[model samples]
Target: MSIEQRVTEEMKVAMRAKDKVRLIALKGIRAAFIEALKEDGSESLADDRATTILRRLAKQRRESIEAYEQGSRADLAALERAELEVIDAFLPSLADEETTRAWVEEAIASTGASSPGDMGRVMGALMSAHRGDLDGKLANRLVRELLGS
Candidate 1:
């Protein structure tokens, strides 16, 4: 089944189990999917689009967690952490730093990015090839390290 369908089914399960954090995260996901459908004027969301939405949601939660922690709000950070866990369940596992480093090296070689000035080209290549799999910050750092050497 598609990610969207799986999410809907899981939402029902969460409701039945009275999982507050999962239910809240799923509700937010469903709402986001509904908004995307409305915007696209489609009956359902494509899995790729749904994945993109999930990634965005996950990123927001991570940022919130960081902010809450920085402000010395452990309770809020914990809540965001719980929400992030729920969101992560639906996302594909991200590439590790080593894998991303390999990809960065390949991107540099393929793009002929010999210096830091060509970082944009290398980054664009990496994003197009591995948009959802790689961590942007990690890939960027790898790119800089490879190109700067």
Candidate 2:
């Protein structure tokens, strides 16, 4: 099933099980998709767009969790962490360090990126190949390391 359909089915299951956390997370996903569709004047979101939305939501939850922890709000941090777990259920599996390194190597070679000046080209290629699978910040660090910059 498509991601949206899968999310809808999961939403139904959450409702049936009275899973409040899952239900809230699923609603947030649906709302994000709906907002993107409205913004783009599209009937449905492309898979990439859906993936991007989920990634953004997950990132937001991560940041919230960090902030809560920093502010000594364990309860809020726990809630954000729980929400992150639910949101992660829909995202693709991430690339491991080994795989990310391989992609960075290939991106550097493919783009002929020899220095930090070519970071953008290398990043564009790497993200196109592994968006959602690799964290951009980490990938950039790897690219810079590989490029000796």
- TM-scores for the candidates: 0.96, 0.90
Taking the tens digit of each residue's C-alpha lDDT, what string does model 2 give over 94-149? 88888889999999999988888999999999988877789787788899898888
The regions of model 2 sitting more than 4 angstroms off are none
State which candidate has the highest TM-score. 1
- For each of the candidates, the C-alpha root-mean-square deviation to the true structure, in angstroms, is 1.1, 1.6
**Clash totals, every prediction:** 0, 0
RMSD (CA, Å), candidate 1 to true, equals: 1.1
Local accuracy by lDDT, each model? 0.92, 0.89
Q: Worst ten-residue run, lDDT, model 2?
A: 129-138
* Clashes, model 2: 0
